[model samples]
Target chain A: MQIYLPIAEMAIPAESIFFVSLFVGCLSGLFGIGGGFLTTPFMIFMGVPPAVAVGTQPCQIAANGLSGMLAHLRKGHVDVKMGAVMLLGSSVGTVIGVFVFKLLKYLGQIDFAISMLYTILLSSIGLLMLYESVSKLLRKKQSVKLEFNQFKVNDFVATLPFKMRFPKSKLYISALLPIGVGFMSGILASILGIGGGFMIVPAMIYIIGMPGIVVAGTSLFQIVFTTSFATLMHAVTNNTVDILLAVILICGGVVGAQIGAVLSRRIKTTHARVLLAVLILSVAVRLSMQVFMMPDELFSTVVR
Target chain B: MRIFLVVLMVLLSAPVMAQSAVTVDLAQESIDITTGFNGADLKLFGVRDAPGRIAVVITGPQREMVVRRKQRIFGVWANLSGIKFDNVPVYYDFALEQVDGDEESEDVEARAALNIVLAQSGIGLEALHFETEENVGPDDLKVFQGALIRNKQAEGRFPEAAADITFMSDTFFKTSFYIPADVPTGEYQIKTYLIGKTSVKDVSTTNVRVGQVGFSAEIYGFAKENGLWYGLVCVMFAIFMGWLSDFIRRRL
Candidate 1:
């Protein structure tokens, strides 16, 4: 059935909207990510309009992040101090990003900019993940217990001033590092209309040298706040947030996520990563094609 | 003495014009758009003393629209140029009906039958163009305007073919058209034009209000005004929904 979206000012099939979110939510459940990168593009392709898709996606991400954070909180996997530090930087980034989004939208270049960003971001991440997972899978089975320096503040990192100790992470590093990482991810999240889960997960794991056990939880913790901030900013400034669309998506999303979580246990880690990589690459390719291909109708009309 | 002359001039012109007296009415004057609104169909009923041709045009409220034409730049399709048109109808639908099954000979008869005044009139969509104001590049405004109408027409917002007006009796005629659900909510004017031989004999316009009425209107209003609070509510609602779904999942 079709339903009218007030903010988007269009009628869309509710089932297609629900099923798209469901698919993305399933991916999120399987990959331990917010699935914004997938959902935003898919919504645009489904003719939700680029601005509405970008503005409303953060609501979905925030909900997914909060749910994930709660689950992690139960397991005590979140590094509250680290998450808080990153949250500070990310919040500022989100404000700047939303402003940029507004500027691009005013200039009528938002759709082009979004497609370009997706192509670049998805391609890099998909290739890197695919390479890493493939190499790991081919390395055979060795539980090589290497000496862990995940929490160790290296001499160079420790001397950078403003050293803060994260008791949960068990590290003393320059506060600027996590803040900077958070800020980058925040900008990315707002501009790209994503949860920044994929970027944040790797950043926390590799850059901050946080333990893998807490990476998902801490990343989700920061994501919840950053996405929430982005959502509000888009709403107040652009008025693109469609509450009905978000509700329908979230309803399908949460259920799909649960199903995906159950299904993930049956798949191997490398296989799942490979599948995600292929999915990401395919979407990236499709988006790039849209930019390069000649459109049937060269003109786009919008009523003011 | 001036009034007597004016009345005498009107009486003298009445027989010379020989125009038809027409009256038009819509089934519903107001359309209520609630959450249950999908689309609606309106029956346009009318009475005419003279029988020749009946044409109905329903046009929605006018608004400014920007039409952007993309160009291949730097190996990518980008919106490099655009033009803005003011006072363009957001929705336009028209129906034309010919009576008496005189389709082939009406053109010949229309030319040879009566003393029809040569007025500036015809069923041409191009004539719908109003004053244009440029907002962007030095491109032809007509091109963009035509593109706008073409695009809207393709989307079913612009009527492709006019419905046939069927006469129920010698004096009564009616026609109907389906309004798509995506039609923008606003005031619409249903114009009924009575045509004779070569010129428009008489024209009547009726107003129809199409506005969001209940829950949808309230939400739309809230979002438009209290955007920040609406955003907050949306986020909170999403969170609540997520939690509820998780709760249900656990139980299942």
Candidate 2:
């Protein structure tokens, strides 16, 4: 049941890889987020080299985004103009991010940096989502009505000079806001080896005032391009991508996403949000524990 | 002239006959690593003309490795410093057998005697040499080398203790060594020494060729040689699997 991974130069159990991808894929489908935040750390914990785990993830993420984007596209939920503008900014952000990643790698601090970044990102995002959901739940119990407001451009976002109209989302906002948001998400996606869906979806909702209907599809559209480009860049520059690992993950992930999408219909959105927040918080806590706790073997040897 | 030559040859052969003579051969000379290869057992048998003690040692190919020690920088553990060890054996195993002795006495004598032979012939794992990079101090070198050995032993790549060599008969003796699946494939040497009271009387050596075979080998080679192409292929494979899975899901 073990297969030899040529690039990583190690043998790992086939089923373990499949199951991890399946679980993450299910979460991605249910939450409408890329599971790279979970997959990268899990692979490292399972003994894949940190570089290979990071390098190989973009390929899997790109595939997942493509499949998910296609589903959303059929429902007329994507704004191609907005996605293109964001993608342009993402490309610039990804280049800068990859450079920083290489610098950290050369300093032998990549692992430490990655863990530190994840701890901060996941916990903050998870806590914020948890707070919002809990307050909404309380308001419902008190008979306070929740309003789905009509899309309105924020005063700060509307004032910028370069105006763009996205007909699909029925929004007229300065293009700079979306570009800035895309740039940040792109940098995060490359650095963390994630699709950055968690950050981008919320940004699209609050900052650009994009309707909820188009957010998921629009975000996924940018993710597919950014991640695919990142994968090729890492492969050519770092030579760290393990193709075998990507294939195994994609096999399970595609199927798991379908199952998750089907299951999402049965659950309430409030409950799903709470569960997702808990999962993210737990991963952050686990990562923090690893950093704070003493390791059993203080010395590690690497073959040159 | 023919009679005089025959007499000279007999005089030279007389000394070899009087003392012990040793000859050794492995059960197999080459090992093929297929996809199903987990590990393999090697059978080495040898004979001696006179009764003495025997020691067997196996050393795999040597390569450079880095040993890093994690330091508590602020609150988190990180790899602060490391030393590169040059010419370290990737795998090592040793076995010893005493012709005549009890357990307690043999343990003490065998160790004392084996050290002497190993030092002289430079044949066993203990005989291996290590050198450090320019920046590493002498004391630091010792710490790194010790850590290297300790980690390798924990990983089961190096033997913690030598196995006992069994003798099937008075003249014929044999020992078995296990090569784990994780053993790096390369040229290896199996050396058998006939140990005397003072020094090594005779030595025999055999070679083993360990390399990957079949489909796995082809893939491994491709990845190592054509890394960029390999990466491209892997990406394509991922896309294909993703597409296949999505298609299957829709049908179901």
Candidate 3:
């Protein structure tokens, strides 16, 4: 039996898709996630073709990110300088990543590579984050002091010749770090067809030692361009972008972002980090299972 | 005097009646067509609307073609739906023999059959079977058939009192038609038609042609084949690496 999805196709009934987007958007804003992790999988589950699913997720990211960024901007959480530098690097990296992506497709190993990589990455991140959060809680119960010792200056980053002062982050780091981060994020965005906000936010916070507020803001800033380029490139070349699906996801994500921003104000930083850690670990576990466990149906084809 | 005046008026009106016949001129005879990596733009000329049907015939290279319906509402243009056709190479002699000896009386019938066959061969109709249409509002339109598209409009309606039609499918297949890089090009004709209740209402045609070679085609072509998995894998890897670096940094 064929079922009609009126919300995605019909303008009048699009609110259904919008509501779903809103929910995802809120989570993206609250957790400082790109929501691509959730949205793309959800789209696939909804019977959308893989190509369309990947292509449309970015438009949703752009919309949700815009709203989330606006809220962060008002809170003075954005580091414009850091974001600008990162944007430059990401732009260059994304273009190169696109080329590499094409090569992989021509080779026909893209699906296996993507699945293997995602499984490994998500599971590892999830496990580590979960371990850290649990440990932190246990230590807090035992009356251990949580000092800011992680803020110590690194010689590798600090010794780089071109040092630039980040007034907002209150750090003096080499331009190389941001550029490197941008390059990595850009390649990821291009290859995975995602906004890369999930990776960028964590990098900013843990590696660059930017405050959580700035990390989230900067990540969103970079995501806008990264995903925009991906969207345009996909539309012109792959013709995979389903504008109908995009509209549905974006409407939902935007509303969700607004609610998420409001809820974020109430959550403590430590708790937020812990939640993020747990989320990452859970995704990681799921990915690892796919790699290690043989399927009941051995002949089952993996959806691209 | 009245009788003489009536006679004079009759003689003068006979010449005006002779000049009332309509004449149509198709500006360009043939066209070279090309398709984008994801989509293609098509145009044909010398279209005429009769009582119950609209017809377009072109004599050119063996190629594929898609016929679309377009509508204009509130000064905006939009595609309504489209049909695809395939053209097979045929000599004039073969075509004439296929029509049989009653050439004059069966001209219209023969033309219709040729058009249908060309359309069926060139443009695959698989996508058309699953097409869907949704009216969002004043300016939004969406059309889809599983993995194919008939037409889509976002901000405005079609400019004519007609529906804009577009044809595209998800299947990745190669075609025989190729636009040469160094061919001398001139204006070509694009034929469009409108189907109305009980009859074909209006027929229109436009001129379009390929010009100098540009980078868009190359860029678009490369992207179509590789963009999907590349974007997906790279982003996932970045997330993994970022977290790994963080974990290592903390451990040290």
Per TM-score, the best of the predicted structures is 1
Q: What is the lDDT of candidate 1?
A: 0.79
Instruction: Please give the distance, in angstroms, between residue A44's alpha carbon in candidate 1 and its true position after superposition.
Output: 1.6
Which candidate's lDDT is highest?
1
lDDT of each: 0.79, 0.78, 0.49
User: Chain B TM-score, candidate 2?
Assistant: 0.83
Error of 1 at A167 (Å): 2.6
Models ranked on TM-score: 1, 2, 3
lDDT string, candidate 1, A107-137, tens digits: 7788889998999989998898788778778
lDDT of 1 by residue, B1-252 (tens): 543453344344444545536776667667777666778887677776675677788888998887788899999999898777787788887777754545566567564542232224424464476456555343577678778877888777887766678877766677776777777888998888877776787888889998877778888999999998998899788778666755665675
Local accuracy of candidate 3 as per-residue lDDT tens digits, A31-125? 66776765665454444544556666665666555555655676898889988888788878877876776665544444444555666666666
Give the candidate order by descending lDDT.
1, 2, 3
- Which regions of candidate 2 fall more than 4 Å away from where they truly are? A92-107, A136-191, A206-211, B1-52, B98-102, B106-113, B120-126, B245-252
**CAPRI-style quality class for the chain A–B interface of candidate 1:** acceptable
Which parts of model 1 are misplaced by more than 4 Å?
A140-161, B1-20, B99-123, B135-139, B245-252
Clashing pairs for model 1 are: none
Candidates 1 and 2 compared: the better one by DockQ is 1
Q: What share of the true interface contacts does each candidate keep?
A: 0.60, 0.46, 0.01
